[model samples]
Target: MVKSHRKDSVDAMKNAAEILAVDSEIISRERNKIEQAKYNLNQLNNLLDDSIDDEIDFLEQLENSLKNPGDFKNSLLLEKLEIIGSRQIPNLEGISLIDSMEISYDWKEAVRLNQEYAKAYQIDLKHPFIAMFSSIELVEISKQVVEEFELLELDKLDYAFAASAGLIAGFIDAIFVGSIKSRADATGLQKSVDKAFDKIVELYGKHERIAELTNQQEKAKTDSSKQNIQNSIDKVKAGIVSASKNGKIVEREWTKHDSIKWLEKYKKVGYDAATNLKDGSFHIPGMSPDNHHLLSLAHEPSLFGLLIGIVDQITGKSTFIGNDGMIQRIVTDNVNKELSGNMVTQITQACENWFGHIMSDIAGSSGSKGRGSGLPVPGWAALQKLQFGHINYSERHSDVTIAELSELMFKKGYDVRSFSAQLIPVLVYETLLRCYWFYKQHFYYGKDLKESVPIANNRELARLLLISAGSFSTVDVTHAIIKSVPGSPQFIAEFIMTVNLPGLVDLGFRSFQNIRNEVSHRKHMENIYENDILIEYNRVMSDPSVL
Candidate 1:
């Protein structure tokens, strides 16, 4: 019986071993199938990626072809492309936004200034002279205008007149040099330039009419010229907006009626919605630097002087009597009769250089904040003031000191008056953020403070820090910090813990509200109340510890 049981056990063991081997083989086959599936999936993914890339490349080429200036129309091509896009391609709005974001700062500014220019002159950007002058050219004209006003020793009040005069002169000169080749000879481009010039002149004439109506001290002729100068700037702004807005839209062959209908549609819908597809700040992302030292180096008032000098050198003497004075002759050369060399190329080069200068300026003036308060300081000067207390943090600042800081913060730091209304809020917010950093660092973090400064970039971090310490109501914290002076150790502690970070931030930004409002509305400097806000700001910024 024992011998029979042993034989059965051996047979059972043999069957079990065979069953385990079969199971192992089945598992191996399944693993192979899984590996093959993954490989196939990866291969399919790569193929899809390649196909998408090819489609995008083809689309890019088509877009470029559509923008070409000649009379060729591709109605069938556009239709075919649209059909293919609708069938196979993804929505390109995000892609276009990314492309806009990636554009150079100079390009962005040029677009913005073009919009302003267009709206000011009530002209389209496609008009020849308007097309010629990009963002950099506007900066050059602005610089020239300011310099000319300085040379005239005009009262600072008359600087606006100088600027306007300078702009008209510059535009007319650019048109002449750009379009007229030699005496009595005109390039094919000349017609567009002439048309643009006539339009500008007509617009300028309107200012004379307005001046007559208002009965201002300036003569109608002078006022018209001055008004034309402003109109030129407005044209630049408008041109920028128009270009950026229309740049991506595939140009289709349009009948006169089609064009009129398109304009009517835009009028009804409003151009603002179409043009301002993104936040309207004239900021170029990749060009700007967060570091103060780097920013200063980056933006260093590039090429404005060089371009001016070059234009001056190449320009031949020819003067035309202008509205304000024969002074318009200073900027406008008689390219129709005089001036030599490739004036077109020279003007082009000048525009390019000016664009570079504007980029550098944008880099220095505005950028993402970094360490050291996570707020933009007015370059190295403000940094110095922050680090070493060169401007005495506790005491009342001298007029000179205040002026310096004001220039640094308002003029160089923010480019307050130069930008579009859409960008005012952005500039104002940034300025306030910087001010908040200054307030916190001086009062909360400096040696006088009883508690350590709360490190925060946004308001939520501030709230979190307060809530973690103890129970507190938002209302109590806001009242203690803003409505009344910050005092009493317990109240200070609570205020430190519970103050409305957003409100405080808003208050800091509020200092620039008046200036922003004035600039946004295109109000004159005389209308701006210099003392009211500045005085309050000075008191608040002098020392937040007292508050």
Candidate 2:
């Protein structure tokens, strides 16, 4: 069985008084110092059976009591020590003098303890005295006292090892400046050294209590604040974990076996325009008609409901603006990590630079320069919004054929061609955006275990993807929400008008008018042209660089 260090240490203290009477000069002349030593060793052996808590208790006492100048003086050992002139402590038994002391513990294990100590006592670890302590110093001093008392047979020990004694010895040796160590050691010759050290600590403890130990008043305030921050982070992470665990989002695979069934679903849905697509761009040709274009045209099978379950983690306010406009404005409260205008613009640009040409080229008006103007679509929407809009338009939303998207605005009648071309893609794009906006609401940072779910996968690898995806997704959605507004359509519309589909400027504008019309008419679902929509939607999903 493993021995208990605490029990052994406590037992050693029981016999310390008896060993104090010996004379140092004639070790044999003393009253059986060997016998006294035997008793002390046996006590240590007995103490070993005690529990770890007891050991720690003994250690605390040992640390304090040993410093008392009169601790050993009260016993026979003091008489023995009194007879000898001042001399350097020597090795004892197999243990060196310095090795007997207890300075500090292991760094890995003690870091938390040390941090607590520092916070509670304002103690600085970088101080040299603290650094020298970790185990060697403690052992060293114990060996020294033993050797000085001739308690152990030291002729077998090495001087090199003796030099590595506990930190307390160094403090005892006047190494530390006008600190407690020097004063205690100086007074130790006449007074009880251990008591002096304890008194000094007790006195200091009083002051430390006033500063940190009590923690009465502001704790309520700090606790409330910390709770608020933690709760927010927890709520977000929980949502992500919950979604990943049970997501309605599914990705399907289209293989040879499914093709027989595929023809039943979509045989004529070739790689035509995105107008061939429906709400989810699934190519619902029979139900939606032939006017729409397929924004996402692939032989593959996959559909993800929750784009990434980690977007809500960041700071933002989720608000329902209208029937179709649910938006979140991400903002950071970090005072230390402020992003400069140039930095914000750069990051925003990097996030949405794809829309650079469209933004610069599409904006109907050059906004005022004082408020971040000269940029495209500068109605509070950054290049990120433009890129996001550009990319989103290309991907799941992009179902309209270029030709159909071309005819969307100028066409006088919402005919069969317009219905097939415009309504389908618009439905697809709008649905995806609405779904994405809804999904981003549940992200959390895993702050509170009770509120936020912990990251359960491979931490380093998986977290990176999650973080990137979350950030980019938020950036993209923010843009879509901002630019989708009618006033801002000219913001990017006029720019796009110069390039490919100038009519989209009108269509983008018309989408807003349609929204109002639907609201006034209380339309069950707002009507739209699918074919004309996917051009912008598919561009986003296909471009790896966009999102």
Candidate 3:
């Protein structure tokens, strides 16, 4: 019985070993099948990738052909060759297939295809959103679109009309807008300045001071004797000095020779630098009492000048343009004591002082006889520092620099009010150009009134303005030449009065800007054209469908 049990166990163990071997064989076969399947799948994937790449290349060629119609025939021929080469035989069937393919470039079909492609690829070709973020700029694409559509399409007739209008306007400007000789002879502009000066004085509660000066003037007029007039002038000067003094600080006594004593304590802090023009104490080169307002940067009627003037008042320093056309600073030796306030309060006080001082200087001082050297136009001082060019004022002084000419202009009453008078011609030219542009665009071109509005940025309108301004400036130049003859008695007067220097400067600046803009625009357009195909490819590739 023991031997039989052992035999059964041995047989059972052998059967188990055989069963394990069979299972191992089956598992090895299954693993080999999986490996083979994976290899086949990889091969299929590679074939699909190559096909997709070929298709993409073909699509790119097609897109290029669409962009450049001139190359369409050559591109289509190449595509035909490719298709025929891919075929097993270059026989009649393949030739017929190539022949059957549409070769003609049809705009309607092209547009339809583009629309379908855009729709499928979830793109709007008309208003393409090429960026994932707003900051990502497609400058080339934008330029391409603008070049394709936003062209200025004005005709010869339009330009003719613009020129005619400008000529008429120029004539009007020469006749109506002459020169301002004095405040009393000033156009509406001087009256406006007077009213503003009066209002500013009233607002600052300095009317009493002005009233007293007026009273002094009235008394002087009543008594025309030279001695009596001198007395009244001396009293007026004394009153102005007394009124201008800051009582909070110790006063510095000035002599009768000090002409600018009225400005001794004008700002509570120090502002006056030169007591008189004859003395070398005035630091600014070529500065005179008549043209000091133009030479001194601190006295400029601008916010930047105001700030500089305030600093001068606080620090007891005077800032002016040097002989070398650079800024120079010097100690004033005028501040009697330190101002009593925090920085903010001091600044506020400085502003008040600046306004009051400007009012006193804007008109004339009580001692002034004529138009009184008023404040220059805001940027007029800058021209004085540009001491280039030579003008023959007279045979005695044959070579006067442009800087001297600027000063002469100021001395001859070319103040801010005069600058305003100069604008009339410019305004007339602009108005005429705009009206003609609108009339032509609306009536002849049949454009809407809104579209016909002559906005500055409109290329057509800008071109018209440039041409018109040129014509107007030409007439102004002619007027100046006709009026100002060399060696004539009226040469100085006519030269300064008739020549619209400001208008000429404005024209030159605008012309430069226009040319620069046109050049830049052309460069951008060229760049867009150079990379048009690449830009389109990139845009198409970015589409979700292409990905």
Candidate 4:
């Protein structure tokens, strides 16, 4: 009886061991699957690139048309493309808002300005002069017409002008073309929107495992880390919401209503729903140490002069992140551009030297938080998160000090900004997402071309930092511009958070560049192409600066 009992116990132990083995095998299989999926994605990308090259070869035949400038538009292939374009084009209504808005706004402004003038120059309603004009009913009617136009909304000011002007011209010259409030532009708008996030996620993917974002994540198991990130995101969401109603929509009392009761009717609204990737999950790209390394170097006071000198060399030491009164792409396309050998080597060598010191210094990124009040100093070693972009932590900040630093760095951080500027243009097309896709933050104000860098063959020292999509369209940018001004489109920011009007503005500006390129290349282009693209890019990429 004792022997039989012992056998039963041994069998049970063996069964338990088998179950454990099966579980391990299952996990291994899932990991392999994920790896294969990643590999397949790379393979597809390579295939797609090869296809693009083939298409370029085919396009070479079309370049023949470039020789004939006037006859170029008559090209068979080009006409076919236009036919395709016309088919995809949106309806007239999409453009009606644009034309109407323009006409109405101009009319209102003209009327309003005229009314102000009349009040100063012609109004005598209260006195005998009023009787004089009023007795001449025809003149009074004309004045009444002007007064009516003046009462339109500020935005409608242009609409009124265009309508009136068109009427004067017999409606021949005042038809508006560009459309606002377009659902058709959604795709482009989303792309414009995605650019900011792409940048931020790109930053995180490259630096997710770095010391700055996820030092804690690295220590935990992957599954555990995922949970922690999710929890942190939830906390962040709550914090952002709780911080203020600034980002939310709510009703408050109006000045005319009972001041305390005004809150009942005057409600504010949150921003438009944020767009996400195809997958519902917020994608935190791969982890990297790029920013942890770059910012760490930038904080160095010792190299401040060299940094400035480098930026000056490449970006004219423009004394600021801008040059030529515009901000150009900091990153130069050295491969295509004819950069002299000396300049390229000097810039590259400088970067290597700078990177080396920042990564290896005695105090390095791990230095005491004493100077920064226990928070990771602006530039320090950190476990960077791959999904969310920039490093996030709370600490005391003296505006005066930051301002002083900005002023000092603006003057002396040329090399840093020069090389760093490269990151900004690249950043402009990036998406803002740090952690996973859930919490997005990124720079909203797209920099304008302050100065022109050599289009080809230039050198500069710069650094790349993580950005967030959330930050790109947040309250700090054009929304602030709108709020600061009355009846400005920026005011629409009061309603939309996900959409950055500044970004739209930039898009319009880029269209202008394309127009220039088309003209330079002698490509048969639309007469309105340049202006249209300019407006379109601005409609998407405009920074608050434009306002």
- The most accurate candidate by TM-score is 3
Clashes of each: 25, 115, 0, 131
* Local distance difference test, each candidate: 0.34, 0.29, 0.61, 0.31
Which sequence of candidate numbers ranks them by lDDT, best first?
Answer: 3, 1, 4, 2
User: Candidate 4: deviation at residue 270, Å?
Assistant: 50
Per-residue C-alpha lDDT of model 3 across residues 416-518, encoded as one tens digit per residue: 6567667666777788778888888899879998999888677778887888778878888887777687668557656777777667876886697678768
lDDT of 4 at 207: 34
Q: Kindly report which residue stretches of model 3 are placed more than 4 angstroms away from their true locations once superposed.
A: 1-149, 156-161, 180-269, 273-280, 322-326, 333-340, 431-455, 486-493, 533-547
Q: Tell me the deviation in Å of residue 70 in model 2.
A: 68
Model 2 agreement with the true structure over 203-232: per-residue lDDT tens digits: 332332233323443464677775654553
N/CA/C clash count, model 1: 25
Give the TM-scores of the predictions, in the order they appear.
0.16, 0.15, 0.54, 0.17
Rate residue 177 of model 3 by lDDT: 62
What tens-digit string does per-residue lDDT give for candidate 1 at 1-547? 9679656545433433333333343354456666766766776677678677757766666676678736435764566566555654332211111101122245346445444544553443333333344467768876775544322222442333323332332233233222112112333333333233334433333333233334432444676676765554354333321222445734232222222222222222111111222453422221122222222221223343334334433563212111111122133232222223487875665444333223222322112221011112223222222322133212233232432332233222222111111122223323433344445556654734323233433232232222221121233243445533444333332333223333334334443453354354344332232444345445643664732
lDDT of 4 by residue, 216-256 (tens): 65567789776876564444333221233778755432211
RMSD of each: 40.8, 38.6, 26.5, 42.2
- Model 4's lDDT to the true fold? 0.31
